[model samples]
Target: MSKVSNRTKIAAALVGVLALAGSNLVAADPLADVQKADGQIHADAAASQKKVDKFFDQAQDMLFEYGTVADERESLKAYNDYVATLVADQEASMKAIQDDINGVDKLRQGVVPLMFKMVEALEQFVALDLPFNTQVRKERVENLKNLLSTAEVTLAEKYRLILDAYSIEREYGNFVAVTTGQLNLDGKDVLVDFFNLGRVALYAQSLDQKTGWMYNPETKGWDTMDESHLRELTKGIRIARKQGALDLFALPIPAAETAK
Candidate 1:
């Protein structure tokens, strides 16, 4: 072959070799690139996790501070918004870190709203003070005592009949209805009214557990229920207040019945 042709052929072969080497070099470090990308994703995911944690912590602190109306309302709104924003932002983040976590975003959704409601209830309770020695408080307590007595007598009699009439499943429902119904048979809103009245009495004693406020039949005077009984009784009162069941402070108290 001619030297020029030979040189051209050698040049063409070198070009082919260079192109093949370049292709292999490009293919060599795919795993390294993947690892670098993974590391970056992990770092970003960690940053997002920090943001999520911050939001939750802020929410928790606000919930604990939810005593006053203004403070609670403002803090609650901010906390709720932060949680909601986190949830909204989570969808986009989930795709990025699906392999790293399982249902982390969804877990907050159920918990956050419930916490929000609980704080809201506590806010209402603190804002609405109970009436203790006032006529409304005194009259309501007497009315509840009367209603409880009447209901206890009536249900004690009818409970047997109810048990005879209903199946086991139906009887359970009947029992609850009979118990609560007897409590409500009299025109008095006994449970909630009594709870509020009792709460006021307890509050007046300055959170003292030793003070008893139940009616003392022998002394004919109200005696402290003591700390243990007070704790039990106050739990119901707090629950009623927190659940907004005791929001009828403006309602007129039922007239107390004369003893038979």
Candidate 2:
């Protein structure tokens, strides 16, 4: 009975040891599971931080691109304003040029008719003036008339020529002149030296220097000069020809008619 009791105690001790080992294994499994869950939480936090850093970098790039676009837009606006001002100035200049063109056309129309009347008046004046250089003066008037009808000459040039002709006519009364020509006395052409004293008086002397005649404007005829004036007339002729020194001499001049 004692031996059987000892065997039963040994079996109870073995069962107690197995129960303690199983309880220790259960507690170690729960600690391992908690450590694994903590590691997974740390990994998730690191991934979220990486995603935030990438989003921040993209936002910075977008801000820089927006600023660049704004600056370019302002620059383009300034350039467009400058171009608009230049176009406005060009338009104003074109308008002024057109106005000047219109004014020139009007001036041309008025000037052309006035030139014709001036030419006609000049021809009449030359025909009625003293007969000295008659043919040359008449031909000058005829040339001006022909020039008026010509298409090659410009209006300004024609006006200048006409003014020059008038200027020459005005200068004739300022000086004495002498020319050799024929005189119709007794209906015969006789060679004579003609002397004019500033459009005041005209005289003719034969080549022999023995006789002289005065032109009578009243009758349009030649009248014999007194023999007493022959020497003085010859001296006057010499002075006119620049062959003798300047000196005073007496000659017959036509009397001026009183205004009636």
Candidate 3:
């Protein structure tokens, strides 16, 4: 094999190993492993590409039906069912694709830079406090659109990459909470950083009948701020800050703050 192809194969092999190992690669050169994984990730990306295209087709078909039909209860329910089914099927595959992407230690290191970009994109939506998270969803669509420009990856693979990044942020979001009240910055108490994970967690809890925030049209903001939202404003937790400031949870905090 050529040098480039050989490197790529080794990288794919690392991804398979990491997938079996999950996140337990302590004491290993994570960056090296990640680089190796990314090499293969791009290669196997072809397999995932087909699934993503099929999903998009199904989603688009449902959306077309939804748009054409009256927005009635039954019609809306049908549309939602279509989406729920699609999401259900894609969730597992997306998870695997993301794990491989993230497990490629190289990719994890780049997450912070993307997080900054994601944060900036997220800020615009959060600021609007749009109902049903219209802004976030819109941003997500746009982000996926932009990821298409990345060379050497299919559009579907790029989408997989972005989704994986969200998962990474969600899985690691609570690390901010762990530092609340325990860590101090500038002698002030830190509230939990409201990012994708916190938003997802709070949203899930609410969906499950637990307490949660509500969009207040009167205030044009999110209301019913719970401990979960404010528990670590000053935790001085570190995040993807090298990429600059990210508007996580609609809050315009700098990447420097995340680095702390």
Q: What overall lDDT, based on C-alpha atoms, would model 3 receive against the true structure?
A: 0.52
Predicted model with the maximum TM-score: 2
Please list the residue runs of candidate 3 whose C-alpha ends up more than 4 Å from where it truly belongs after superposition.
Answer: 1-143, 172-197, 200-219, 222-260
Candidates in order have lDDT scores of 0.47, 0.86, 0.52
TM-score of 2: 0.60
Q: What lDDT tens digits, residue by residue, belong to model 3 across residues 1-260?
A: 69999999999999989886875555367878899999889878977998899999999999988877756877879989999999998998999999898777776467646745664655454444323334455676566556655667754466466677467544544533311111123574334323233332221113222333433344444455465543232221223322334434432232232221
What does the lDDT read for residue 208 in candidate 3?
A: 24
Candidate 1: list runs displaced more than 4 Å.
Answer: 28-33, 67-260
Q: Relative to the unseen true structure, what is the C-alpha lDDT of residue 122 in candidate 3, on a scale of 0 to 100?
A: 52
- How displaced is residue 7 in candidate 1, in Å? 1.8
Better of 1 and 3 by lDDT: 3
TM-score of each: 0.23, 0.60, 0.20
Error of 1 at 258 (Å): 62
**Alpha-carbon error at 54 in model 3, in Å?**
82
Total backbone clashes of candidate 1, pairs 3 or more residues apart or in separate chains:
5
Lowest-sum lDDT 10-residue window in model 1:
176-185
Candidate 3 shows a clash count of 14
> 1-260, model 2: which lDDT tens digit per residue?
69889899998899999999999999999999999988888888889889888899898999999899999999999999999999999999999999988898788899888888888997887665556787898899999999999989998899899889888888887878889998888889999999987667778999899999988767767789999999999999999998999999998777776100
List ranges where model 2 is wrong by over 4 Å: 1-100, 258-260
